[model samples]
Target: MPTHYVYLGLGSNVEREIHIDMALSMLEEHIDPLRRSPIYESASIDPRQSPFYNLVVGGSTDLSLAELNAWIKDIELLHGRTSSTQRFIPLDIDILLFDDLAGLHEGIELPRAEILDRAFVLYPLQQLAPHLKHPGLGISFAELWRQLQPGPQLSSVRYPFGVSSFALTVQAGRFPLPGDPCQLAAI
Candidate 1:
């Protein structure tokens, strides 16, 4: 079978510190990634809580879209995720790009529509691989990064996580859950 290009977006606001790492480990184990973006830290758009650590991973995989989605949900459950919270969790792994598919399902949404609204996701995604295009949108992550208004409180750190800093960033704060727009953009 021909491999498909996939980009997965990761976020964790609830159990910030441990969740990102947990999610990353799960992703690494389950997906055959060619590369992963450096983690970016940012203020949460949702008003209720704290900031989030966001990043994108890119790779070619043989798995079909449904298989990948199944794996993503399994990883989230393993990390103590409850989709109901809107509160932050041990992990939130989203399928940002999957062969140009888009829309919501079973009350869940994909491609994270608000992706353009957050500077953190776009910047780090640009840093990770500026050339990669959102197949559905016809725009490159780096291109989108330039158009975004930077948030003063939002900040991004370098990647290949060290224990202390990674821990500190992840445990930061829980922001209100993202709305449909942010969630859909990544799709």
Candidate 2:
């Protein structure tokens, strides 16, 4: 069984595709059986700023929540993530969920706030985990997305790299059933 089942939100507007790809590679080093949502493009906080490429990844981690946060912060710094006043954020990774534990742990909140408020996070997350209830809200992600007021339009991006290889059924709480093969990415 997986030790720490989690979901993460990733975004970038600085060399968006390359940064996202690089971040995904680093994340795979610590999170196994990673599954990702299709890329989504949404306008940045300011319409004049470069649009952002965003997606969500789900997987299991062997590290505790605090250890994972430290690793994630390291990834951002290594990627040259910088102030976005000029829209030059190389990469940004946020911990959206860590198992089902709610409230705060190690000064980090579970089921990140963005999951409920940001379309970039919510859309991709629902694709990867539509039925999994929010650890705090107790409502399915699918339902939360439905309740959301219209926000920035999120269009799919045809990112030709990175693979989303985990099974959606895993989010539904069933994995590796008899004769069920692991999900494979196309391209």
Candidate 3:
């Protein structure tokens, strides 16, 4: 199967650190060299809830979009995420972008709506793939981040996971694509 590049959003307000770490490990097991953005913390969009740590993960995967969506939902359910609960979620994983795909696929909107409306999603996405253009908007994520209206304040922070290298955080320039030959692991 051809590799399909993807970007996924991960967030958790309850057991934030633990859930995020476990989600990272699970994603790495599947997404290969999962490239991540610095985790950003902000007040939960749902005013009744606590703050949330959010980040975006990118990599190439061989699974079809439907298969990938099923896998993500499974992970969320395993962590106690349910439609009936919103005040405290164990984990929430959203597929932000899948290659240059746009519109609805696998019943999930591509380039997730939050990428355009929420600072938490766009900021981390820009860090991970600064030059990647939104498949539908045709604007680079970096530019989108710059144009975003002032909203929730975001602060980048390190998750206190015992293992720092559990996931690769994109610190400078652009992270590698499927085969850009970057020093970072691509598998």
**Number of the top lDDT candidate:** 3
Worst 10 residues of 1 by lDDT: 178-187
Give all TM-scores, in the order shown. 0.72, 0.82, 0.84
- In model 1, the Cα lDDT at residue 100 comes to 59
Ranking by lDDT: 3, 2, 1
| lDDT pick, better of 1 and 3 | 3
By lDDT, the better pick of 2 and 3 is: 3
Candidate 2, residue 50: how far the Cα is off, in Å = 1.3
Decoy 1 TM-score against native: 0.72
lDDT of 1 at 105: 44
Candidate 2: where is the Cα deviation over 4 Å?
82-86, 161-187
Cα lDDT over the full model 1:
0.66
lDDT of 1 by residue, 1-187 (tens): 8677777778777656577766766666646764676676776667675768777887777877778788888888887876746576567777766655566643445566756776666665677668767655778878887878866455555444554433334454323343412111111
What are the C-alpha RMSDs, in order, of all predicted structures? 10.7, 7.9, 7.9
Query: Candidates ranked by TM-score, best first?
Result: 3, 2, 1
Give the per-residue lDDT of model 3 (tens digit) for 18-90. Answer: 8998999998867977988878889987799999999899999998899999999999999989874668988
